[model samples]
Target: MPHIKQILCIEDDLFIGEMYRRSLTKAGFAVDLIASGDEGLKAATNKQYDLILLDVMLPEKKGTEILHALRGEGKDLVPNSRILVLTNYDQDDESKMAMQSKADGYLIKADITPRRLLEIIYSLDVQSTGAE
Candidate 1:
């Protein structure tokens, strides 16, 4: 497989953000890690990333809102990208919202080990875009 470059990580936790950047960078992916949905959205307007790692809860808006913005085809903003939902809450409502938003994959923070996350990333199909 080709290397994964240009990753956008939209998570609020500083420690987790750093950890995700480290993980993706170590795996040869260039990462733009941010702490809020609003920041991520701004960056998306100018930067075309290969993948977007989004969190459910964000400062300005939820990941669902961001995902909706990215879904319509005219989104000539970002690169042909896929979104990976990374959140601690996998509750029914959260899952439904994510699925509705069409997230490419869902990773429940509490249930994932680092190695397991790597496996999930690798296993994802390149064409996978949107949620669930």
Candidate 2:
């Protein structure tokens, strides 16, 4: 049986966040949507989730900054929880930084559909399981 996943979606845009939440929820994943970077960072550090959908440009803190902090010693993020950067940005400096900071993947939001996003998450599940 496929394991049910819990996902944390950190997006400042209301429309995008809700869309992801609704789609992911319908796809059989438990989704937690956090609108602000600060709240997202707090939730990420305090809880263990199966996957994280992170946005780059956010209020209070940038997603790269949050990824850096989580990958560092200060915050305790789940080691197995896949973290994917979901933003409009492409392979720019910010995306490079996120990759260097241990982001599992970086994807342009405009280029992906919700169904494809779910597929990527499932692929991450395979990669994560193999890594352990």
lDDT of 2 by residue, 73-128 (tens): 55545575778988886657855774546877888899998999988988877766
Candidate 1's displacement at residue 10, Å, is 0.2
Q: Evaluate all candidate structures by whole-model CA lDDT and list the values in order.
A: 0.74, 0.83
TM-scores, one per candidate = 0.80, 0.86
lDDT of 1 by residue, 1-132 (tens): 233467899999898889888887888778898898888888876787767888878889787777777764445344466678888865588656645457678778878866677777766643353222
Using TM-score, give the best candidate's number.
2
At residue 70, candidate 1 shows an lDDT of 72
Clashing pairs in 1: 102-130, 102-131, 103-130, 103-131, 103-132, 104-130, 104-131
Please list all clashing residue pairs in model 2, or write none if there are none: none
* Cα error, candidate 1, residue 79 (Å): 6.3
**Any runs in candidate 1 off by more than 4 Å, and if so which?**
1-3, 72-79, 94-101, 125-132
- Badly placed stretches (over 4 Å) of model 2 are 1-4, 73-76, 94-101, 130-132
Return the number of clashes found in candidate 1: 7
What lDDT, from 0 to 1, does candidate 1 have?
Answer: 0.74
